[model samples]
Target: MESDYQSLFQVRLANYDDIPAIMNITREAFVKYQQMSGVEKLAALEESYNDVKKDIDTKVVLLALSDGEPVGSVRVEVFPDKTAYLSRFAVKVTSQNNGIGKSIMNLVDKIMVKKGVTQIQLHTGSKITSLIRFYYGRGFYIDSTDKSRGYVRALLIKEYQKKDC
Candidate 1:
């Protein structure tokens, strides 16, 4: 099943024209987070086109497409210390459980590795067990937790092994 999906799915760096698709997917995906965390408003849900465009200009923004249509998206910014911060990762609700999220993440790892990023970090609601498990399965581990957002948000980190080549 995963392989079948992979054949039809493609991940690519996003461009200016992709802002609309990215925004749509983010809203569709993060609404679930807002509901699960009981947060009435989220930064992801409030982003405007300019905000996404700025991200596209400064960060690594990617879109996951299935048969030429956008279904998922993610953004990551790599810092001077070779650490990257991932944000706005989302797969459409209709496309969940189809291996799209995992595929996007796997591509993220490969892209970061090529960029010499030693670690990648992201935060999510601690109570989202399924999401936590998904991160764990993708080689991420909890580094800490913070309640500054009125709910526990777990900081997860994934470290890449430097190739000896």
Candidate 2:
């Protein structure tokens, strides 16, 4: 059976009441990372409703909907310098690999571009080759790596073309 994702999911900015669904998607999405890294408490899995609500107030939180149901989310923090940080990207386990992640990323890029951001940054586990490849395919490159926090993280950056949007 073919999944008709194009006709299924819609993306929109999230609201305060969507925090629980956001956390649920985040938790479900990070499970593989938790099992792979042998870390039981990934930051995404530990986020509080208050934390997410704060993000909703201060940052760009995008939600992907399936039949009006929340199925995925991504958060962005735009800085004073027009550089933005992307984080907590998640798609429900059942919705994975259906272009939901790619769609969210494309939506984020559009959102940042509209905000006049010149670049977007994000960090991921250094050991996660598949994730690195995913970001690479999206035009992000490793700007640096840090291990001082007791785990390796690859800092990736994607620069937007100069445009008057």
Candidate 3:
């Protein structure tokens, strides 16, 4: 029996072989955002296929596939503070607005909840307010702003608390 959203597509742990597809999506989505932000430092956030492959050992990469085609990807890393760092979430531009991003985020939220995480955190350039709003829609709130970094960005955190059982 498949979950309602399963649709013959599985969201599961990514492997080394998925790096190329993951990087392609990442570069395509973030490259232009980098250029338009007047922040050359955005170049530093890029992850090549090799770099993404290395992350497999330290982070959880979840890939969303439809009919065996890679359509989206997300990464979550748990810190010593028991908080999960969610980043590098990307979906093919053509696949936007189809709930792919939401599905990936939901999957990560469940995993973190099971792991006993108290919160999740992510950072994005302040200019990307839409992305921040997206997070907010997902129940996250801006925790602070860090102008001391390469570019003015907001640090957002989402607390995860189990509902009354």
Candidate 4:
């Protein structure tokens, strides 16, 4: 029988108490990318618990849980121009490849739409082939790149357009 991840995982907005787990998961998730890119100082890996709490206070920090343990998380910070900056996306190293990241992205997209956002954007290490493929598969295209910026990341963007009948 196939596993029903929706039934197995709980998705919810994070609280201050969840910051430590969030930080740990984010750090662990980015370690592979760091190793791949030779960028040890990636901001995601250096995020402090307080920094996460600030995000919880200001933006959206969504988490997927398994029996109350945080397994995946992503942050969405909305801007004034109908754009949502999606960042700090991370899934537990052990919980990856199990559709957890997709679940989080789908949920976050819905959340953004409900918040009146028309565009979603994020940055990922350009050297990570899997990430580039995943983002492309999700309908995001490489909007631009600033190699001089942190870690030579790619700025990907996805726009939601309302259908006209």
TM-score of each: 0.95, 0.90, 0.86, 0.90
In model 3, residue pairs whose N, Cα or C atoms come closer than 3 Å (at least 3 residues apart or on different chains), thus clashing, are: none
Task: Please report the candidate that would top lDDT against the real structure.
Answer: 1
Off by over 4 Å in 1: 1-6
Candidate 2 Cα lDDT to native: 0.88
Per residue, candidate 4 scores C-alpha lDDT tens digits across 93-128 of 898888888889888878887888899999888889
The list of candidate 4 runs beyond 4 A from truth reads 1-6, 163-165
lDDT of 1 by residue, 1-165 (tens): 676656777999999999999999999899998999987668999999999999999999999999889999999999999999999999999999889999999989999999999999999999999999999999999999998888899999999999987
Candidate 3 lDDT over residue span 1-165, tens digit each: 455566766678899888888887777667755765557765426556677877887898999887788888888899888888887887777877777888888999989988889999988777786677788889989888887666777888999987789
The TM-score measured for candidate 1 stands at: 0.95
Higher-ranked by TM-score: 1 or 4: 1
Of candidates 2 and 1, the better by lDDT: 1
Tens-digit lDDT string for candidate 2 (17-70): 888999999888889777665654677777889999999999999999988899
Q: How far is candidate 1 from the true structure (C-alpha RMSD, Å)?
A: 3.0
Clash pairs, candidate 1, are: none
Better of 1 and 4 by lDDT: 1
Write the candidate numbers in order of decreasing TM-score: 1, 4, 2, 3
RMSD for each model, in Å, please? 3.0, 3.3, 2.9, 2.8
